[model samples]
Target: MLFLAEKRGQGQVLPPNTGDTCSNVTMLDSRPFSVLSTSVKSEIRKALAPDILAFAKATGISREDGFDLDKVRLDALQIPVNNKKNKLYIVHWGDMLFGVNGAIWIVEVNSHKGRNLIAPDEGRNRGRSFSGWGMQTLSSENGSYPELMFASKGYYAGGGAKADAQCVRKVGAFYKINTCPAGCDDNLNSR
Candidate 1:
């Protein structure tokens, strides 16, 4: 497990980051409310609002279609990669309505690189129908980048209900999906 140092010299314990690859998969638990100040959280949310709206639009949902920015749930974690000076943000946001849509954004502020894990078009099937999805992070051995698991549940083509999981890791400048159980291919083209 890695620990983050607080301003007062106290250590804040984070989830364990071990192994060459992500394993010991489990359902994602509720994240801590937030370690950031209220103003900082508001700023982050404001910065991401446009992207969220764009996603909804791409999924054929409009502002009048029950898409409310205020109703979205956002969770963020600030992680120090190489040192305390350099940091990365793991942000996850989901709609409060049935968890119909959600995404994970990994941002490296120092590097000016941001990766959106799920594409808007891929989020919904036909402009309205969508799967309920969630994400979990597993710290990598290097402790610089964490492996991610995206799990989703939805109906099958034949009307049968199904659930799926996929594992993703940062390779060079992009995130790639590793072969796993059924339904992992849903977000194959996502960045």
Candidate 2:
């Protein structure tokens, strides 16, 4: 029993948001509002795990301790970078039992440099970079925190202050720091 509207003159029925990836689609039913089937969720996680783990390794977190599978949460919005060919995967995880609270990690897909991770921290001073725990919540526009993209001027302390905010974006495989002066926000400590 399909309860959708059928256009009188239109010959074909097209689903909305066809331009977007099928991963972002949601099927509505009469039962109740919730996530899709477990199989779909599992596939999403399976596809994301490798990339996320690679990012973890790059950030100095060993693959074994990279991310707790039980705690990992994946965001549905997998959008491509504006003009770049790479896509972004937003993820969230935390060890509530251990009192770690919350943390978000961004994964860049199809990047020439393999995997990239962006972890933001508010307490870190701007214009300087340091590596430690996790990132702070700047925005959750697409269900998950997406502000890691705007944390240009702030410190990015992954792997013991490997690079300043200016060099965070260019970080490649194994946390290799690449220089990109154009992406930097400003030379001053804004935060």
Give all candidates' CA lDDT scores: 0.49, 0.32
Model 2: per-residue lDDT, tens digit, 54-141?
4455556663654575345433323223435544543333324213222333445442332334333321322112222222222233
Residue pairs clashing in model 2 are 120-135, 130-157, 130-161, 131-157, 131-158, 131-161
- Candidate 1 lDDT tens digits, 23-138: 33322223432555554455556655767776677677777877787666665555445545434555655545336445655544432333343343333432212232544455
Q: Which stretches of candidate 2 lie over 4 Å from their true place?
A: 1-41, 48-71, 74-77, 81-87, 94-177, 182-188
Specify the highest-lDDT model's number: 1
Q: lDDT of model 1 at residue 27?
A: 29
Clashing pairs in 1: none
Tell me how far the alpha carbon of residue 143 in candidate 2 is from the true structure, in angstroms, after superposition.
Answer: 27
- What TM-score does each of the candidates earn? 0.54, 0.30
Worst 10 residues of 2 by lDDT: 25-34
